[model samples]
Target: MDSPSLDPAWTQRQRPPRLERRLGFADYPQVQNFLERLERLCERRQRYPDLGFGRTYVNLTIYPDQDATNVGDAEEDFARDIDGLLN
Candidate 1:
């Protein structure tokens, strides 16, 4: 059977979203340990957390699990050291 038609707008693929947040760390050991833990978890979890590392900073992005509205929950749950990073 022929499929029902979707709205023209719906048929178009969305642009790759430019969604992200930058969090900095001054204490290298703490941040490295935190990212390592997160990397381990991502190996077992499906949320697919990504960290974009800089000389002294990191950018966070998660896919297929959250959007802008509830991104904080992921940060809180994944990045426990987030509080330290913020200070």
Candidate 2:
């Protein structure tokens, strides 16, 4: 599938998608939802999880995890950082 030339509202200034969409759609919301869940269990830091222009599908685990350890000791900070990128 092809992506829109315009930027997606969920992510900041994204370029034209070069990755292939696995599910025949951008699936932006799906990926964003996963990121949201992940954000709930991480330290305060900058997140740059680029699932690649809708090229991938999210497979979330039913557990809490803090994978990114680059900020303080709160997931809120990381969430906010990722939130900024998402918007």
Candidate 3:
């Protein structure tokens, strides 16, 4: 079997894949729906974190979709999951 380092794509600084999706967050309900879908996808794909004792964790990072002018409040809202609507 070929080792990872032996592969052609392997290098000193191999870039990891960036899984990005441009989701819309115009309102609370929409944000909640997005979170629900994200959670379901994690569960379906079994993308849970291992804690070395059989316990699993689901980590999420919510961010704003607005530009520089609308960043502050919208960013806060996104970080807080649309005022806890996503919780």
Candidate 4:
């Protein structure tokens, strides 16, 4: 499948075919808030991304669903929604 267009903030990958982004915050509380919001988003959309976070940053990786070989519409939309959390 052809890859979908994604936000510039998200890095598109081949091979495994995934999307990734890193978000930064000033403190742990801010990171916590972002995580909470992301959780809500995931619950609402029924889509979740791989997440890694420390005191002030989150590394998010989104892979195509199922056995797909490329990023597609759902992944693109999810990436966009995640970016919206920053606004």
Best by TM-score: 4
**RMSD of candidate 4 to true structure, Å:** 3.2
TM-score for each candidate, following the candidate numbering: 0.46, 0.24, 0.33, 0.90
Instruction: Rank the models by lDDT, top first.
Output: 4, 1, 2, 3
Alpha-carbon RMSD, each predicted model? 12.7, 14.8, 17.7, 3.2
Candidate 4 stretches with Cα past 4 Å from truth are 1-5
Tens-place lDDT per residue, model 3, 2-75, is 31222121111212221112334556665556566655654754442111111222233323232333223433
Model 1, 15-74: lDDT tens digits are 443234565667677568667765666666545556687556667654334345443344
Which prediction has the highest lDDT against the true structure? 4
After superposition of all CA atoms, the RMSD between model 1 and the true structure is: 12.7
- Which residue pairs show backbone clashes in model 4? none
lDDT per residue as tens, model 2, 1-87: 642233222222223312111222256776766556556533333333334334345421111134532322232333344334444
Candidate lDDT scores, in order, read 0.49, 0.36, 0.34, 0.92
Whole-model alpha-carbon lDDT for candidate 3: 0.34
Task: Single out the weakest 10-residue window by summed lDDT for candidate 1.
Answer: 5-14
Error of 4 at 68 (Å): 1.2
Candidate 3 has which clashing residue pairs, if any? none
